[model samples]
Target: MNSPVALFQELVQAGPPADAAVHFDTACVLGGSIAGLLAARVLSDRARRVVIIEPDDLPVDPGPRTGVPQDRQVHTLLPAGHQWLERWVPGITKDAQDRGASLVGPDQALTAVNGVPLAADGEDHHLLAIGRPLLETLIRQHITSIPNVSVLKARASGLQYRDDEVSAVRYVTTTRADGDEQVLQADFVVDAMGRSSRLSHWLGDAGYDVPRLERLEAPINYASARFDRPETTAELKISGVLELFTPDYPSHGVSVAAANAIEGQQWLVMLMGYGDNRPGRTMEEFRSACAQLPEIFAEVTAGAVRGGVVTYHQAESRRRHFSGLSRFPARLVSMGDAVASFNPVYGQGMSSAALHASCLAAYLGSDADLDQAAHAFFDLQQVVVDAAWAISAGGDTARLDAESGAQVPEDIRQQRWAMNQITAATVLDADIARAFNYVTFMLRHPATLADPDLLARAVTVNEAARVTR
Candidate 1:
């Protein structure tokens, strides 16, 4: 088995070797979300025909869709995700910029954790803060434009199997009677239906052993509101700002606050809270929350409000370990939230989905057995899922502790203490910040933080800072 760090490095590479020949005939991707769209893009290269089944009538122009409730929120495409988008669809960042998305380098983005701002590490880490709607639209357009790819507006009902392998998809079209079902022949099928995906139940209903579902209860409530940007503030150096508060570092009642200069000359601001300390939906309450955050948040919110505050709540973070299953259907795989859905506050949904697409590309590009389970694809995807899960669930687990007033487990206390020290050291040390950012950006694995020398240095730096204070 490949080490997690090595696997992550391989997955992050620009593209699956370009010489991999087409091997699939027909591929069906359910759900037209980022995951499904990216999957279609990857399959388009390997399959003779690829069909994306999305229930919503995707708009020609960039706008919010009913399928994605959190579309209006400030969506930041981390450097890793930006790289994958460009790798799959060349010049996609430029395409988004042309459509009014904002791209910012390290100099133009501000990141502070627990009231301590990280010093610039002199590294070139650029991110695109394209609101989710616009980013999804661009990917949808690019994928649908492919000669071999087409989209169907329908709801997938179930899967059809032959010789223990998925062979077709049964779906109901919006134009037909609600109970009427039609079957589409497919050599391969992908489930990208998101966190609410029913692929597990479908498998169990068909007598296949379903992978264990893991859940970490995270009672998180978040609200996002848009504000008009002032023309005079064009001189402002920063286009994006993020302040994160952990259980170790509580900021009033707020968990996180982020502001981004999005398209339409507006500043999109989001405030998040946990448990009982929920953000209010009213504009006044939203502004009050912003006032509690960094001064940048207040300055941005000083302008006219663009729309009402949009609020969303997530109950838990979930993951299905398909790789752990002993038996599974062939020619069928699940991606995106169907496999794992982490806390949205980490902004890992879309980026993780993009990485999953990379795994699919690598799996299909290889000459593999189609009559058996897709363990190779599941293994590659597990690394991507676990990387995101650790960052997201780790923080939420701490919050759960705070909520219950429970003590940290004795076995994990040392690890937690080490991480806390590292987090504190990020503000004082530039190199540590770069390493930390690399992991958080999903470009590297979390194991990189376990370097003994790095941990020792973090402790020493934090001790010195405390002595100085």
Candidate 2:
């Protein structure tokens, strides 16, 4: 087995494998989510036929769809996520731009601490803030265009096994009122139903040991509202802005807020708060919160509010330890939020899903045993899950009260202090900023921050910054 860092590097560096190796005769994906769509794209490369089981009546033109209440919230494509998107769906960024999404380069992106923007390092990394609706629509279009992939408007009910191997899937169509379920024969099956996935229950009901679930209580509430962007945005040299308040000085009880120049010539600004600091849903409350944030938030929210404030809440971050389980069936795997769902404030959902697709591609393209459980794929996926989980949950754990019944290890507490130092030093040093950005963008693992030289520099820079202050 390769080291986690080595595997991560391989996942990001490799593109879709050659289509010469066909692995499965028929594969069924449970949901038509971005994760599922991407998985279908990968399966189309290896499977002769791929069928997506989705319950929603998704429109040809993707405005807002049912079952996705969070579509109205602002979503981000980290630079690493953008790389995977381009690797999977070639020219997708350009397609989004043609359709009105903003393509923000490192120079055009802004990250501020306590209202002070970090200095630009002029790196080659770039990101797309296309918002969830447009991004999903474009990916869905590309996935549907593949000749071997088809989508079935149905809800997955259960699985059928033949001699302990997944042979088919059971689902009920959306138009059916008789409550009749149909079986679709699948040589392979993927569960991408997201956080609400019932794969565990299904497996337990069938006498299979289910993966143990782990959760961290993170009562996060955030609200987003769209507004008309200023025509002079280009002149301002900022296409994306993330204004963050450290724990020491949260602005008006708001921990973080962001403004992204999304498609439709508008800015999607979001305000987030933990536990008791819920953002208001009314327009008046939204504007009040923005006014208390940085100047950019005020300037962007100054425009006429285009829609009502959209709010979303997540009580905890969860992960299912599938690799730890030994009694799993062959020809079956789960990805995306089905395996692990993290805090959305970190913007890792889509990108992590894309990487999970990369893991699927790697597994299918490899010479692994097809008659056994997908432990190899799970190993590769664990690296990605651990990386994302650490970034999102690690921070949330620190913010919660000590009486919340959560225990923090001494080593983890020490590491968090070091990370805080490095983050604070980003505003003062460019080299450190680049390295920090690489980790935050999901381009590099969090372990890189622990390098002795980097930590020494961060300490030095932070001490000097304190003196200046």
Question: Where does candidate 1 have its weakest 10-residue lDDT segment?
Answer: 245-254
In order, candidate lDDTs are 0.87, 0.87
- Model 1, 1-469: lDDT tens digits are 7898998888888484667687778999999999999899989888899999999989988788888887888789988888998988888999888877789898889899876788777789888977888889889888899999999999999999988899999999977775699999999999999888989888999889898899998878888998888887756778888898865564667888888888887889988888777775899998887777767878888889897899888888999999957778899999998899988888888889888998998888767797788999999999999899989998778657766788877777777788888888888898889889999988999989988898999999988988998
- Roughly what TM-score does model 1 have, to 2 decimal places? 0.97
Give the alpha carbon lDDT tens digit for every residue of 239-343 in model 2.
888888976775877888988888878889999988888776788898988887777777888777787898899899999988867888899999999999888
Superposed model 1: Cα runs more than 4 Å off: 14-16, 246-250
lDDT of 2: 0.87
Report how far off residue 374 is in candidate 2 (Å): 0.6
Worst 10 residues of 2 by lDDT: 398-407
